[model samples]
Target: MEQTIQKRLPVGGDSWVTVDVYGEPDTPGLVVVPGVMSDAHTWRHVAGSVDAWPSVVVVNRRGRAPSGALTNSYSLRTEIEDLGVVLDEFDSARTLFGWSYGGLITLLAANERPIPQVIAYEPVMRPFGRHALPDLKVAEGTADWDRCVEIVNRQISGFSAAHVDGLRADPHSWATLRRLSGPLYAELSALNAEPPPDLMAQQAEQADLIIGQRNRGTAPYGTSFDHVRQHVVHAEVHELPGQGHLAHIQAPAELGHLLNNLAAI
Candidate 1:
């Protein structure tokens, strides 16, 4: 493993954003945006697997440690503006990759401006994505983040109970999960109020979309693919066999290799 460089940049008005940089400084590659309940390190393995991807900058996003809070007025638009700042720092890379909620952010950002290459893995652009998860809200109010993460993974991401239990068994992973889950509750609620991605095809010049084969008909992801293909007309969708929503975690090397190759195409 190589040393990760930390960069704090000004973004979203008065707030400062933090990002983790992997690979060489001269080899600035893609700007990575992580999904809900995740941070930059979550994608480091994927970044390391790519041969040509010398530098991968993974934004911590908001509401995580060493970063700004999920302000009272936070919404998806806040994330898009934050991404815009990170993108400006890596214009040389020109490539953007996002997973889940972050995927939605990249796609939305591209529509706002021109981006040469945009790739999203299961961007959660579900039709009428406004479905409410009241139980998650109750858990959040009581500061029961473990329960919050369990609710999200099981309900929204469709994770099995055993899988959730396995995560709980690991102290480090469990702690991170608890910390990250806080923002997700707010983001999902905010998503409910936003319009569907019915007209997000205005940009993403070379849109490359990937989804795990196992997630083909799963909630959020299944309908999300339909929304992406329906609107992001130029998007080329690919399926990762024997994998589901958590391919990056379950199969980082394989997923990263595929994405690395896609970057060259």
Candidate 2:
């Protein structure tokens, strides 16, 4: 399986963003956005499988692996700008796909652009009350990296072992889990410092919502989606039974098929 990988230098920085392009260059474009602390590599398996799409660009969001500068402040506006920089470089009309935090970025980006289509696999709209974190301990008062890692590890391990095993089996999914464990916790702490209620509402208005019925970790757990569904005129919901947060990994074939159908429409 051959893949074309490129280090794209998006304007506004020297930090060259990592981009993985699959299939032909001139084909209809699909941009894959990874969740927090994830890299372009997270979409490797799915990109390889979706050969029908003309082009798929997987992005390594700023401050993640294979990218530069791990900053302490993780602002939603800055993250959305980073994505805008990437979008400016591409010539083709594109469809945006986001998972978890990436979904938040995707929704924000759509607000600033004329995105013809958008697909999100359970975006973390927690600020809108769609997700809850009862046990989530926000790390503060310490900039210690090791402490951050320890806190994140403990939280991850607390989840069901069977669920973790299912994630580990998928290369694309587990790679993200391993790389993002620490940074995700740190970012979560930063986000907790200042909840983005206004931004969350803005994102919901912009996105064509796609809700996973069993995605209890994010959308299913909160009232954010309910608010989003009410406002977004083009919002469409799909319920996948026996699937959780990582539906793209757990049900890749089903997701891929659905995406293919979406592209056709």
State TM-scores per candidate: 0.91, 0.74
Question: Highest TM-score: which candidate?
Answer: 1
Q: Pick the candidate with the highest lDDT.
A: 1
Candidate 1 stretches with Cα past 4 Å from truth are 1-4, 26-28, 126-132
Q: What is residue 185's positional error in candidate 1, in angstroms? A: 1.3
Candidate 1: the clashing residue pairs are: none
